[model samples]
Target: MTSNFQAKIEGLQYDALQIRRNVWRALHGAGSGHMGGSSSAADLLAALYFHYLRQRPDEPEWPGRDRFVLSKGHANAALGAALARAGFIDDSVLDQFYAYQSSFGMHPDIKMPGVEMSTGGLGHGLSVGLGMALGARMQNLDFRTCVMLGDGELQEGSNWEGAMAAAHLRLSNLTAILDYNKVQQSGRVGEMLALEPMADKWLSFGWAVREIDGHDMGAIVEALDALPFAPDKPSMIIAHTVKGKGVGFAEDSYLWHNNLVTDEVYERALNELGAPE
Candidate 1:
């Protein structure tokens, strides 16, 4: 890579690290939150806000801005961190996560400046994103729509319905990214409800598909850059990731999916994540 390109990657990596730190901070302040999925999604969220998605932080209502919906709304801590870091909202709002009357609750709230859809009920974001994509097409707008999905959320039959519809309509401007962290709220997704042949399933539904390491900043950027993998099909990126990625104790453990974050636990997580570069 050229020096400039390498610097860009490093910059995004720093953003991802800071996002993870802020996620822990927010959860700790709330006394409890969804750390596993939030940490797992930090890298992808960083890539989206800092690199891929197009938006004016100051003019959030810009008509040409691309739309991104966090289908796995449980990971809102990471989303909130990204939005705050990108200047869409006040950085202090991170401290208000899960606080009474705070818009930054456990799920994405549309009332929040950068949040496209109020989501938390799994299996709904994809459908909402499809509608956004269709609306863009109907209005002859160039804005693209992207939705981030959870591995466990795929089990909801509604997602597949949206997937099938997006492809049938040939909405190439639409993209769906799956954060396949494997572990969910109760147990490993494989043990609960397997989604094997994942790429093939999307391909079979007529969507273009790609798979990559969710934590690899370079890979994530490359995937986003290669949008609309097919001119006549919507694209899908299945990003394999580890639950609670930056912290050792919580990694791949379902118990940490939505557990208490005591002060000691927060300190350990921050230590493992290290100071932002």
Candidate 2:
């Protein structure tokens, strides 16, 4: 907990706030969006793009760059915000969310400079990320692959298949961050499909697992620093987060998952999140 480290965390915290603010802006511009998942992932996205991943924003196609697949692609607003803040994309793109003929949409688009995978259908990102990890190993590249998944997305069953494969293959370069926001669209995740014993589930699949408060910048950074928690196993970080984090009314509510973002709602959310620099 050195002063320098604290300062670094502080900077990330600021970026996370800005990311959240931008999430609301993007959704407001689109008149609606998946605000719950997007805001829930902002802190981790900030830490990953700004501090953890070895990526070249100016040269997104660099072969040596790490790969990040947003498995919970509904949270693309946060990813877009992070990329913009990191200089991988122009800030104006945030206003184009869901616009007709716009590359930026509700989901991640591979054509987007920094987006490694075009994903929106749940339970697919892990498998794609596993392939990237395997490909990196086959090519003798030192690059790593990380995937961010939503709590509800795990119910798809494909994620477990990929999890099993990654563990069996011993892809240490692969990491999965589960944005366990607890609530999902329509209702609380447990109400729709309970993933109780979630940590145990990943452990049983033979992956190294760590649970952390996803919104805490310092904790998030520490967890990222301890990647590949085991030598021959892919790492799984269960990031406990809140749906619609940073906004009082929306927080923990499924209604805000992808609801309409009117002008009034936008201003209220921005007030809670503060002005973005």
Candidate 3:
């Protein structure tokens, strides 16, 4: 990679680490929150906010800005961290996670500056993102729409319907990223409802599909840079990640999916994450 490209990757990596650290910070302050999903998504979220998505953090309501919907809204801690880091919201908001009447709750809220959609009801964001993409096309705008999905939520039939519709309409501006960490709240996704043949399923539905390591900054950047893999189809990126990625004890365990983050747990997690440059 060129020096410039290498610098970019390093910068994103630092941002991802900070995002992970702040995710723990927010969850610990909340007393209990979804850590597994939030940690799993940190790298991808960092890439999106810092490298891929196009938007004016100061002018969040800009009509031409690209749209992103977090379908797996339970990972709001990570999203909040990204938004704060990107200057779309105050950093203090991270401390308000799950606070009574706070916008920074367990899920994304449209009321938040950088949040495109208020989502938590799994299987809905893809459809909403489809509409956004369609609207952009109808309005003759160059903006794109991306939706981040959770593997556990794919069991809902609504996502498939949106997938089929976007493909049929040839919404090439739409992209759906799956944070396929394999584990869910109660147990493994494979044990719950397998989504094997995952890539083939999307390809069969007419989407241009690509799979990559979600935690790999280089791979994540390359995938986002190659959006709408096909000119005539929506794109789907299956980003394989690890649940509770940074912390050893929590990694890959469902117990950390939405567990208590005691002071000790928070310290350990930050230690594992290390300090951001």
Q: After aligning candidate 3 to the native by TM-score, how far in Å is the CA of 269 from where it should be?
A: 0.7
Across 1-277, the per-residue lDDT of candidate 3 in tens digits comes to 8999999999999999999999999999999899999999999999999999999999999999999999999999999999999999999999999998899999999999999999999999999999999999999999999999999999999999999999999999999999999998889999988998899999999999999999999999999999979999999999999999998999999999999999999998889888765
Q: What is the TM-score of each candidate against the true structure?
A: 0.99, 0.99, 0.99
RMSD of each: 0.7, 0.8, 0.7
| Candidate 1 off by > 4 Å | none
Q: lDDT of model 3 at residue 211?
A: 99
Q: Which runs of model 3 end up more than 4 angstroms from their true locations?
A: none
For all candidates in order, the CA lDDT equals 0.95, 0.95, 0.95
In candidate 2, which residue pairs get closer than 3 Å at backbone N, Cα or C atoms, i.e. clash? Answer: none
Residue 241 CA error for candidate 1 (Å)?
A: 0.5
lDDT of 3: 0.95
Any residue pairs clashing in model 1, and if so which?
none
Model 2 bad stretches (over 4 Å): none
Q: What is the lDDT of residue 142 in candidate 1?
A: 97
TM-score of 1: 0.99
